[model samples]
Target chain A: MGSETESARRLLTGWGRTAPSAAEVIRPATTEALVSALSRRPARGVIARGLGRSYGDVAQNGGGTVLDMTGLDAIHAFDPDQGTITVAAGCSLAALLDRVVAAGWFLPVTPGTRFVTVGGAIACDVHGKNHHRDGSFGEHVTALTLLTASGDMLDLTPEGTPDEFWATVGGLGLTGIVISATIQLLRVDSSAIRVDTERTADLAETFAKLRASDDTYRYSVAWLDCAAAGRLGRGIAIQGDHATRDEVDSVPPVPGLKPRISSPRWLSLAPILRSPAISILNEVHFRRARTAAGQIEAIEPFFYPLDAVGDWNRMYGRGGFLQYQFVVPLDREDVVHTALELLHRERIRSTLAVLKRFGPGSRAPLSFPMLGWTLALDIALPAPRAARVLAAIDEHVAESGGRVYLAKDSRLRQELVDVMNPRLPEWNTVRRRLDPDGVFQQDLARRLGLTGASP
Target chain B: MNDAFGLPSRIVVLGGGSEIGQAIVAAIVAEKPADVVLAGRTPVTLPDVPAARSLERIEFDATATESHGAFFDSLFAAGDVDLVVLAFGVVGEQAVAEQDPAAAVEIAMTNYVGAVSSLTHVSTRLAAQGHGTIVVLSSVAGQKARRSNSVYGSSKAGLDAFTEGLQLASLGTGVGVIHVRPGFVKTKMTANLKAAPFATTAEAVATAVVAELGKGNRTVWVPAILRPVMWLIRAMPPRVLRSL
Candidate 1:
């Protein structure tokens, strides 16, 4: 019984690696064992943890048991005709993508990295660049098995447990642990993306072109100039959609089963971790993209450009980094401009700043996305008075009824969260039903007093 | 997962205020602890347990047999419980017990009948959940009845047998019962008594329980050598054993 999992008390930290906490971690091999552990009613409580990619303490439970769900990774069911896969919550997107891609199917939504788990994606309701075209990750999920605190398993679907299901999605793993899920996948002819690259002269051009033609592209994302003096926000806008069989034919096939132009590996490029380094790289990258470029690229490089470099997170240095993502209504385009200027004025440097348009607010109350523009900025940790900078930006957002992403936030004030998520009361009603005893808890929940685990 | 020292994560000691039970909880938590639920009749004094996120103290009366079902149902419904320590028992003075049949019955009911009621509920709940361990604190006093504490001995003897039955019944269910027998342990229950030959301390009993749990043993005789020594005690002539 004292195997690798036993006697191995590890210091667990979220993906940000900022706030580390010691915890007893157990990996249950089967669904029954997992349920038993959950049903035991430990005083410290337990929370299901996946790959821990959240840039905050959402996955860590200080002085509690963190159920390492990664061990329960299983591709349980797959129906080729339906183009859907029923998989364990712990199955990583990378693994699922590999299997489905070979079968001419692709994930309905994928974040910037392919390392996230289905459970984490659902808990965070992770939104990808194509959220404007489709929706957040939760929209495609047809059904999932929710194991409540009482150890009873509930088959929750978009229809079966409407309120509970939506509440579970983006509910921050507080309602219950996602045992397994069946999600709809998009069909694709080939494993490639047809991309068009355009260099925006300034923020004006970028927003104009994006707002004008975002509907044309299934996926679109812009790499912004975080350190621009005169031409701030001038960078590259990359737009793409799954390549059809005809487009695949138009682009000459690589000789001898090899890609003609091997996808550019991010590692081949010089490290751009520091603010100054990123500024120079952005300048050069922007200049190179002044001319329009169109190419057929592998699906991976196009969707998960950062995944090409293993341990890319280390680039943020030992201090780690924070991904502060916020969304303001479309009518408040001024909020987006004011926000970039505020970061510049505050002298808070962000190495990677991205701007994307969201189609409409998701039905999931706590979800990060809503109609209008969402800006995600990755700022290195230990920035001076980080709280102040975030609070200032949050004020600008809150005034316009905008909200920050809970999955990525580490410093959002409790009161601020209450004000931001208006659907909190509705979500709480359903949450209490799933975990009435407040058995499921984590560091994030404890800090914010979510799920009544505070006492 | 056990603690960094490889102790279990969540453990509930039924006799919340029992010195020996508290010692076991302290020892386990001191080494490795995620949560500790000390359930007993009295409010517990929590140890300096920084590693545990929660040290829940619940008022649990062992003689309340009728409430065992709802108590355990609520406990299981609350959260994930990994291990349960059935450590509630009392040794009524043999003189007082023999003089008053009611006193003897009270001793028997609290020590034997109460445990049966609690353990039965625990066994069923854990088995239904498909995982967990129930560690019952039996005693070597049950190995053979001496005149001085025959009443206590008889109670433990009944508990030992009941636990054995539950252990066998739990096979393949993932839930298991462990019977732990300590010989004349110097605890609060035996504070003023003369130390018997080979008598152990509560701390020693706690250490043994922790070690046995690590080994996943179904039966543990504290001061491990007692396994063979008890055989000799059982074989001793009743005349000689009674004299001692």
Candidate 2:
């Protein structure tokens, strides 16, 4: 057994703050060891983490041991005929994408960042731009291996253990330790994206174009300028889908097509993140988007722009930042405009503001996306006055029948959570049955009362 | 003092003037425990400890064992006492203890026997409730009987062992016992002791304990490395262990 160390007790709560404490952190190398360790001491609460990408406390359990699942990453099996791959929970989506794309197969869905673990994706029920066309990553999952509180390993799927399986899909690691999973992969023609990029003058124009053009494309997303008021939500909208080999010949060859190249590490640092610097950069970026032109672009550049900057999260400074992502129904498009108008009126300087239209809801009850338009903003923390502004926005979202993404939430109040996601109680019930001892608990759980278990 | 579960949790610290106890209470208060009770023999003389608005105070005496049961029963009858922090004990000179056995016995009973009786009553109620956490303050000196302070160390050792056994027996039933083994802390109790290596302040210990409580830890050694140090000490021969 490895000795618990203070250095291992550090965690990056969704707000990007490294909360340090003294804990007996245990990194189990194998599923057997993980089960034995859990059965032996039965941690008061345990949270599983991989690459620490979560913007909030979903992966952080104060004072409790965090099961760092990254070490358990290992590709187990691949069935070419079925286009399915089975891998340990800790295997990164980036690694899988690289390998799968080489074989003409691609992940059915991927979040903006490819560095997240499969288990992390399932836990958060992550959605991508294509969510309007396809569903969440949970929809592509075929089966999972779960280590329950009783130290029993259960293989679950939609058919076998439907309730437990669906619960675990978006259960946020509260159900059990996900050891491995078999996921069905989508076949693609090439590694290129057939893209059409356009810039709109304001919120109205952007919404009009998105609603009209989204049906023609498999992937659609927009970057809104939250800092702009009367013409709030004005920004660029990009739409794309997998390109066939024939389409690439008519367009200029895309640059930097490989996925393995490491993005420059210093781009996210404070030296470039200052408000004035960001504003200047945004102006240049807006000027570059002159027309609705089609281009052949590398999939890496199209989906994961930030991936080009390694460790980009560090750019937010030591205090870290909060990634506030909330969605409103299609009918509440006016609310989205109002939200943007408020941000612009407040002159709140956000680093990045993304808008996407969600296609449909998944089987997971608490999954984030639905038939709505989602807007996500990244704001730096320690903004003493920003909390009030965010609370105002939260009220707007709740009134509009929208909810904030739990995976990205850090500073939201418990009261807001209770009202936003009415399914929380049902999710808690399923969670309690799997982890009867309340072993899988975290700061998020404690704050939001996710675990019905006391204290 | 609420149990680990924080249900029916009502903690009352007898040493209202103790900095260590006050810090522990402050940490416990953050858990949103049902209630907190601060008490002392001379409750009127005791200075106000920073407490949650939900916390209350009353008169308590460690030596008054005759009324201890009834006093606890009344509190329980009002509500359940999930946890009780027995943070009332004395630290005195080894020379004084050796010269006067009566004074030594009083100190020993207050630190050990008195704590045992009170904790036993609280533990029984918690066991009935089927969930709780008891935070007991034990000292690192109890890792081994020290020539400098064997009497006090022995008392802590007895309390530590009892708490460990209690924790073990309560397992599977939801009741938890946390044995807090802090090194020399700059509390009112250790104000006269020479500053030692790795000594922490009461607030630091309190913070560590609170963090550990959230994690549902059974045993915690402040400056955590002491757990290994204690293990090494236990593995050493008697002659070597004593000399060290």
Candidate 3:
């Protein structure tokens, strides 16, 4: 009997899997089916869910109807001449790349994982390590089809419908369900990256090296050893760009897009993921890197190394882990140091930490990337003192004119939303016009008070 | 919503007057400031815990079973509650309970019937909200019934069973349940009774339960030894149990 009821209601969660909510899920394989699902108008409202890789509650609609767009995944068109492709909102980047990579094309921008759906990418306005060069995913989108609250499909683009287009970009799917989208892909000769590796002595050196080579490198990121006490900010900087035919040894077999191994559900490494063990792991990783330049690497290892280990999040245990990512302006780089010092003082250990430099800010109101340094880290749950310490850092970041990434945040305070995302009011104005009835809602919207008082 | 450390930002205590209940709230507030709501039939004075951000009291009668559905609906309608401690229960004297049928009925109604009614409503609300922890203060008395305290023991037994099942029902919903079993916790309710073996205090039970909340533990035994002791107590012969 319990199994019957449990099967009826779908329990949804983000990649982090920290907070889960149950909802009635409806998969629409066609436009007509999507419209039929939308017409139901559940009392709690409706929202769209993709591959569920936003890291938080961005894709969840608790007690409401969730449109599982994965069923509508069909590549509508492909224009190799124009370097563009039109795919369904539910289409995964991995699937799209698999079709395009062999033909010398790639996603203009991508996050750490390629399993995310096209709709989620535009909804989050995801940025890659090349954010310093190419901006965000939304910037590369040529056009999109939005199904508004009133049940009207509107074709939108940056120029044709600036307000609605930008609103849908990093909109967290609150505006409406995205039906389909046309994205401009980057042209590549081979599926390999010519990389340059540098081990920085400290945070300042890493920042200086990144800033010094900002224009020279098309893509760059640093892996910081936050757990190392004396060598607190020491890191390894990896910068690279797509390799031409001459740069790689036969293009690495067109790059395998699927995950080779999956992490078992029963296995848990939480006990050993503590401070002592993590510090040792961090030390070994730091020492292992060499100052090698022009190292040829496959696209898989260069961008999505963790993706190879499927369901890697299970390693954090059932309590789940949080990925706290915040971006501070270039001048406020000291905030990064303060956050690391505070975490150390509170005796909190971050298992993984990545530091990246972003270029100019996005036009979209809720977009996360800006011309600054962003530090993202993962902390295993039940860290008793982590709340107070992270809240303190949130305050400092807000005051320093920085913002945390909503796509990755699970516990950011509601009051800090306005201060961090100053353009929230502007986004709300556009969102209200598009969804005046407020038919689309999500858990992240309610938790962070993103939307005004509930309908 | 819980913060980064899993510290509940908002907490609700059903039996506001229970010493063990108030102690649990104190333990949480000691860690960090949180908004607390104490609900009971009798109005409870705001505890002077400086760490608590805000303390509010409301009327909540355990025996009023029919009103539970509406009561919880309104409570959750206001906002999401992170932690809810169901501590409202009466410990009636077994001697008086056996002699007076009405007394035994009152004890059963308050502890078992009322718990079922209120917990059913609380679970529905928390499950819909998708994130929260329900802490149930069960007892070692429920481990096995004693001839001396059969009525009260049986009442706890029912609650213990219900809470265990509720924990399973709540799986995958992100709602956690902590079934707390304490042996002879010395509180105002148990002040008149003689202290049992390996006796503990209400504060000690509170500390253990609060610590277990962050660990994702479903069952907590105060003083820690009651768990092992209960094992032996359950295995004892009926003839040997009757002597005690």
User: Which candidate should be chosen as best, given lDDT against the real structure?
Assistant: 3
Q: 1 or 3: which has the higher DockQ? A: 3
* Docking outcome class, model 1: incorrect
**Error at B35, model 1, angstroms:** 26
Q: Which residue pairs in candidate 1 have backbone atoms (N, alpha carbon, C) closer than 3 angstroms, thus clashing?
A: A39-B79, A40-B79, A40-B80, A40-B81, A41-B79, A41-B80, A41-B81, B16-B40
Runs off by more than 4 Å, candidate 1: A1-7, A249-272, A452-455, B1-244
Query: Over 4 Å off in model 3, which ranges?
Result: A1-7, A269-276, B1-10, B26-35, B44-55, B80-82, B128-131, B146-150, B172-174, B201-204, B212-217, B238-244
lDDT of 1 by residue, B10-109 (tens): 6788887677777777766654434778887765553334546577788788898888888888786765465788888887889999899999998898
Q: What is the DockQ of each candidate?
A: 0.01, 0.03, 0.35
Ranking by lDDT: 3, 1, 2
- Residue A248's lDDT within candidate 1 is 77
Q: Write the per-residue lDDT of candidate 2 for residues A239-300, one digit (tens) a residue.
A: 99889978776433222322444535454444355476667767777788866666878866
- Top-scoring candidate (TM-score): 3
> DockQ for model 3?
0.35
Docking class of 2: incorrect
lDDT of 1 by residue, A307-352 (tens): 6656676666655667889999988878778878888887777788
- Give the lDDT of residue B230 in candidate 1: 92
Chain A accuracy as TM-score for every candidate = 0.92, 0.92, 0.96
Superposed by TM-score, candidate 1 places the C-alpha of residue A298 at a distance from the truth, in angstroms, of 0.7
Model 3 earns a TM-score of: 0.92
